[model samples]
Target: MILYYALLIIDPSLIGIFINPFIVQFTIFTRVYFIACLLGVLIPGILFAIRSIKSDKPEINLQGKLLLIAFISFTIGALLTSSIPQMTIKVIARLILVTSSLEFYMGYLLPNWVKKILLKNDN
Candidate 1:
């Protein structure tokens, strides 16, 4: 994967073509990369989140849920950004990407304020 990405960085035209100044059509290599990411990262992440959610600890469960949301939102955002041509839809996708980043941060760190608010709701 690293080699493939490196090659792409060195010569983007080897796998991709610019539709216009702003848009690049998806290529076979790009599709393969997306598939690799989905299988390698997203699927495993979702599985881990599910396992965590099933744990006995409330904190773990909350973290799992947040992580799950983050993963799902990130996927949605990426797909929307790549597939849609409209600028407006792209903006919405970027917002979802930002939300996913925030969710991932909260899940990984579980800050005191977030923990208090989330745990308070459970009680």
Candidate 2:
């Protein structure tokens, strides 16, 4: 998704050619770009929640919690965007920061605890 966004930025003219009628002005492209970015951020939250639900292991519940946090943060950021000028940049920055933090937590912090729990359960 990020790669797609990059492509859009690099060649807006090429992209516009595919969907020419919809993108009359630069503002429309900007709006579409932002919307795509928002959806890209959202996909992981939804996927994580679904994975958490499907997995029987109770230890996998962290994904659901992260999803909730993501949703709440997104709502708050959206509200702030409406009230503040130049909020899109702030919101995007916040999203990236939060996403990276969550990825780190999942990659590093969760692994040790998950291993410990699985090992304990095995015994």
Candidate 3:
């Protein structure tokens, strides 16, 4: 999911300044975007990372936003990322959608389609 969002967030204003003046107050926006990306990476690992955080205590499993956590992990896991806030948001949104689509496909549609095909052949 995070991978989906990160890829979707390509820089739109790279063509030319005249073509797109969307970049304003460049420094602050850039920082926020960086933070968002960092969050994307950290949110996931931190969740599962606790499985071994305390050796003496029982494992504490996490249960929450699957996609959001995945996206955070994806963005953080990336080796490099652009500082563009808008672009980062684009990627994050897309990642969430893609993750949901994948969940749907895997849990319901894929199995049903396969079963339907087999049943049709039997008929």
Give the top-scoring candidate (lDDT).
1
| Clashing residue pairs for model 3 | 2-71, 5-91, 5-95, 40-72, 40-73, 41-72, 41-76
Candidate 3's residue-wise lDDT over 9-103, tens digit each? 66523222322443332344444666675776566545544443333432121122333344444554332223333656546655655665553
RMSDs, each prediction? 2.5, 8.8, 12.5
Tens-digit lDDT string for candidate 2 (19-81): 233223334555466566667766776676667746666556654555555554664564344
Clashes of each: 0, 0, 7
Relative to the true structure, how large is the alpha-carbon lDDT of every model? Answer: 0.85, 0.54, 0.42
Clashes of 2: 0
Best by TM-score: 1
Q: TM-scores of all models?
A: 0.82, 0.43, 0.25
TM-score (C-alpha) between model 3 and the true structure = 0.25
For 36-90, candidate 1 gives per-residue lDDT tens digits of 7766768988998999899898889999999999999998898887777777898
Ranking by lDDT: 1, 2, 3
- The predicted structure with the larger lDDT, 1 or 3, is 1
Q: Which of candidates 1 and 3 is the stronger one according to TM-score? A: 1
